[model samples]
Target: MIEILMWLAVPYIVIGLVFSVTHPDDVRSLEKQVQTQLPAGADALSFGAATLLWPMMLITGPVEEHCDVG
Candidate 1:
């Protein structure tokens, strides 16, 4: 069970890291939507959340497009 979960998490973690690094502004924007405080390491926090919620993020599309629902 643990091995299966780890394998799943590996992809998410890798993707999350790439997204966070390449799209820091998008990650910060997401952080702003969920939290009141924008601390120094908030990017890391957002990246962690993104890893856990990758499926939702993938379904929702990019942050810019996701927010532009009018």
Candidate 2:
């Protein structure tokens, strides 16, 4: 079970690393836009959490667009 879970997670981790490194501009843009819009205490945590939980934001859409709706 542990091995299987590791296998599943590897791809996501690789993709996240590649996306973050390759498209830093998008991440920065999203971070800046979101900081102003997020609740006062949530700004910092939200970005890091969003990156880990929804790595696809690097491809699927802007982090703010996906994360700020809530």
Candidate 3:
């Protein structure tokens, strides 16, 4: 029973971790979509506030921009 339970739990654990990691950007992307519906620049301050509140600014946005290639 333990072995069978472990097998079933493994996939659930992996998918849970995947979704936990991805959930933030899902929120951010939804925010961006809402921003698009508004006039230009409306979401900029909200994003800036969120990014500033976030602890890892040094780790994220710059890397994202660099990855996008001009």
TM-score of each: 0.56, 0.50, 0.34
Cα lDDT computed for each candidate against the true fold: 0.69, 0.61, 0.49
User: Any idea what lDDT model 2 has?
Assistant: 0.61
| Higher-lDDT candidate of 1 and 2 | 1
In the predicted model 3, the residue pairs found to clash are none
Q: Which ten residues in a row have the lowest lDDT in candidate 3?
A: 61-70
lDDT of 3 by residue, 1-70 (tens): 9999999877765654454344455335535555656657645643544444343433464333443322
All candidates in order of TM-score, best leading: 1, 2, 3
TM value for model 1: 0.56
Q: Which one is best on lDDT? A: 1
Instruction: Please give the TM-score that candidate 3 achieves against the real structure.
Output: 0.34
The worst-scoring run of ten residues by lDDT in candidate 1 lies at 61-70
Q: Using alpha carbons, what is the TM-score of model 2?
A: 0.50
lDDT of 2 by residue, 1-70 (tens): 9999999988976766666666565556655666676756454554454546555564577654555433
Candidate 2 regions exceeding 4 Å error are 34-55, 62-70
